[model samples]
Target: MATYISKNLISGEEIVLTAKNHWLNFFSKDWLAYCLSSNEYVITNKRIVVKEGIISRRIVEINLSKIESVTVNQGVFGRLLGCGSFTIIGSGGTRETFRNIDNPVKIKRAFQELVS
Candidate 1:
């Protein structure tokens, strides 16, 4: 299926990595909402994009040059399950966190490679 990220890419931009919420998210406190909506994390050659919700949508984009750091948080179960949360901090005090996402480390590493 075509995603919000794919439809909005700028000229010469290409997707580098994509991640979705892990199955463990179904056990989260927001399980009902999680089931009803979808969340997507995407890294492109030029930026990071997060798309949330199924019907009513929220999209956040941060330029690669603006990203300052990426941090991952994982518990015992998360480590075993290969799912964790990623916190991305960008210039101008922009901070966003994606929870229960699969392969958080891979996502972080991809972003780091793009910016570095």
Candidate 2:
């Protein structure tokens, strides 16, 4: 299936990186719900896009110029498992957190490369 990002890309925009929820999510209390819902984080040359849910959907898109900061948080287990959470803070003070994501540091780095 075509990704939410692909269908929405504008001229000159290309995806830099894409990340999904980590395998560790299977052990969480919301495992079943997590499995039912899909979470995606996509970074492009011009923006960051997050798509969540299955039957229902929640999408958040932030232009690179409007991003203030990206923060990664990991516990010992998460560090060992290569999964964690990243928070994106927008210029308008909007904060969005995506948790249990694989290689969150890589996502942060990808975003840094685009905005820097």
Q: Which ten residues in a row have the lowest lDDT in candidate 2?
A: 29-38
Task: Write the residue-wise lDDT of candidate 1 on 5-108 in tens digits.
Answer: 88889999999999888887788775764686467789999999999887678888998888899999999999999999999898888899888898899999
Which ranges in model 1 have alpha carbons more than 4 Å from their true place? 29-37
Q: List the residue pairs that clash in candidate 1.
A: none
Model 2 has an lDDT value of: 0.89
Indicate the TM-score of model 1: 0.90
TM for every model, in the order presented, reads 0.90, 0.91
User: By TM-score, who's the top model here?
Assistant: 2
lDDT of 2 by residue, 14-113 (tens): 9899998888888887576468646778999999999987777889999999999999999999999999999999987999998899999999999998
* Segments of candidate 2 deviating more than 4 angstroms: 29-37
The number of clashing residue pairs in model 1 is 0
